[model samples]
Target: MVKAAAVVIVVVGALGYYVWDYNTSPTGGKAKSEASASAAAEEAKTHDPEVGDCVKVADPQGEPLPTVVDCNSPQAEYKMGEMLPGTQLECASQYDYGIQYHNSRGFDYTLCFTKV
Candidate 1:
């Protein structure tokens, strides 16, 4: 009987803690769920490269995925000149480098870059 009573007391204590925590929390136990969803949505937003932005190339030999960086930073190697939609591109002679990005979903674009 004593062991059964101890187990019941432990279970009751756990339940009491849960009730207190839920009542004291501002969102009543929904804060974590709501915050996680909000954070996921924010992270899903994509960054679009624009003209005049300084970009860094991780490797010229590999597939290009230029990321924007401060022009004054050592990692920045090129200055974006033109951004055109689609794969068919004719970058002007002034641009020193050009990269064509092909999106399998059909939203392709080309980026013209000049040496920084």
Candidate 2:
């Protein structure tokens, strides 16, 4: 009986230590990692490609995230042409592609690009 009680106590103590260590970690556990990821996504969403700038579209569906790149690079698939004040539907006929960004905070813009 004493052995069983000692084993249970040790197990519980070890588990409690693990929980404390995880919660007190410098990175603040999974919550901090998730917040960092969210911050990164927000930053990516704000990347505005200027006219004539070469960009690489990371995702063409949903909210498109385009990264500016050197025009000569292979990943440079599109060259920005015009920046409209509205959605993708407002793209000019001369532009081959358009990526629109609409946020709840009143920032709405579109980036028109030509396939390279």
Candidate 3:
């Protein structure tokens, strides 16, 4: 009988904690769910990191090297190098996103990345 009482008390304490936490947390609000989902959708729509998007490569060697194969703009060509992906790329930090060249460009000129 005493063990049963202890178990009941423990369960009741856990339930009370859950109720208190749910009411106090910011995530408890129904408004945050809709806002979170909308923010997620907007983030998904905006984050399009694709190839052929006019970029300047920021290599460890720094700045554009001499051989830029695909860029039509001299400015874009002037910013090419062996740049890998997910390295915070931009033509410069202030401008829009630069193209992320896939790292498969061998001697024959191709782009490659390990697919997740």
Candidate 1, 1-116: lDDT as tens digits: 99999999999999998988876787777677777888877543313458888988766667877777889999889999998888797788999888888877989888889999
lDDT of each: 0.81, 0.83, 0.45
Question: How do the residues 73-115 of candidate 2 rate in per-residue lDDT, one tens digit apiece?
Answer: 9989899998878664578788888888888988788888999
The residue pairs in collision within model 3 are 104-112
lDDT of 1 at 69: 82
Name the candidate, 1 or 3, with the larger TM-score value.
Answer: 1
Instruction: Sort the predicted structures by TM-score, highest score first.
Output: 1, 2, 3
Residue 13 lDDT (model 1): 100
Clashes found in each candidate (C-alpha, N, C closer than 3 A)? 0, 0, 1
lDDT of 3: 0.45
Better-scoring candidate (lDDT), 2 or 3: 2
lDDT of 1 at 85: 85
How many Å off is the CA of 34 in candidate 1?
7.7
Q: Which residue pairs clash in candidate 1?
A: none
Give lDDT for model 1: 0.81
